[model samples]
Target: MCDECNQYFAKKIEKRVLEMPYFRDVRHRNFIESKKRRIPVSKGIIGGAVDLKKRKDFGTEVIVNSPDIFQKILNGEVKHMIIPVNDQPIEDNKLISRFIAKIAIESAAQTFSSKKGWNNFIINTPEFKELRYYARFGDKLDMWNYSQRRIYNETDRFLNPKVSDGPYEVLHEQNLVFLRDRELYFVLVLFGIEYVISITNPKIDGYKSWLIENNNKCPIIEKNERDTIKGERYF
Candidate 1:
């Protein structure tokens, strides 16, 4: 990847994705690592003002509407605090589908590039033409149907004895679920939310049916399949 194209994807595509509330809240509340170019979700409305930041000891800590309120809680001057919020992020299907398509293709290319003639195979494959176009130019092509669901809450405190806090949260996990006669599905779990897309076709019914038969288990943590390279990932 040239520096120009790298910057283009980061600034043009990935930036928009990380800014989405689905991502923003996950990164902020869970304090996931985003490296240097990461944008911190600073301000939020929890029925009032809030400042998100790291803690002195470890993990995340939020400063509430005012210093006094925060200090009051610390000093035991305030007994209880309640924050009620309508926290659902608006779904941008087009933007997210583009991302899924982009990563799915890239991961597949990376996996197969080492094999002789595979790169050319991907470049010239007629099946992937529309998906490639959709990834690079969203909405200019017809929208693709994808499925999304939350497996767990973003701020869920998971038990982890290794960390400073007894709890830890998931940052991200992904896998390319490729099987014979099945639509190539990319399963990306970001901060406990699962986003699945079929790269081979626009329909998501294939994944839904697969899930039902598999007892609704997430593909990432499922029993590792011996074969992973029918389509994508570090196969």
Candidate 2:
């Protein structure tokens, strides 16, 4: 948030961009387009697994299911907050994605033991009920599809894995904090990227509306345009 921090991150990002193999030829063009269009040049998401065992607690992952937690984060009651990233940008570039993920993890560690951390993350009963309803019954139509059901089953396996003959236990209880950490990491990274994009591209219009309307569409690909190439190749 500070000027120094902003400059530091910008420099770090620039350095990473320069080191990338593709940047040698396209560097100048990329820089020009980025500054001109206010679009962040991204490298894409970081691949591979994150080790959550070594990570400091960023509060209970289940707390995200509570909308109030987001409100508290916005209110600054929670010093560490994870912002959800728009899927479009990540799909477009890998460097920005990796940078955002790194920042999220670092931010969590930076504020892990803050006095004003997760103490205000108390669950709201009504909110919990609403979330539960949506998770269970909100998408009945999609639930009937075979592929959707399979995906849901896989998610269930991860979130509530079986233990011997006993009932399934929550993932965190099973010490699968890595899953939670990865989820939080992506959310925070996305938030950071979104914030940077907004600041740099203040003149770009309809960004919010575009996000809403095309949330499910691929940002790197133009649907219904037969001659247009998709993904990073287009650039």
Q: What is the TM-score of each candidate against the true structure?
A: 0.70, 0.22
Residue-by-residue lDDT tens digits, candidate 2, 1-235 = 3486457556656456544543322332223234444323332211211111111222212223345655665677766433222222323343443343334334434444365543232123343233223322323312110000000111122111222343331211100012111211112211112221211111213333344576633232236422211123222
Q: What is the per-residue lDDT of model 1 for residues 74-123, given as tens digits with 9 covering 90 to 100?
A: 77776644433324445547878888888878877877889999878777
What 10-residue stretch in candidate 1 is worst by lDDT? 226-235
Clashes of each: 0, 10
Off by over 4 Å in 1: 1-4, 37-39, 42-47, 59-89, 152-170, 223-235
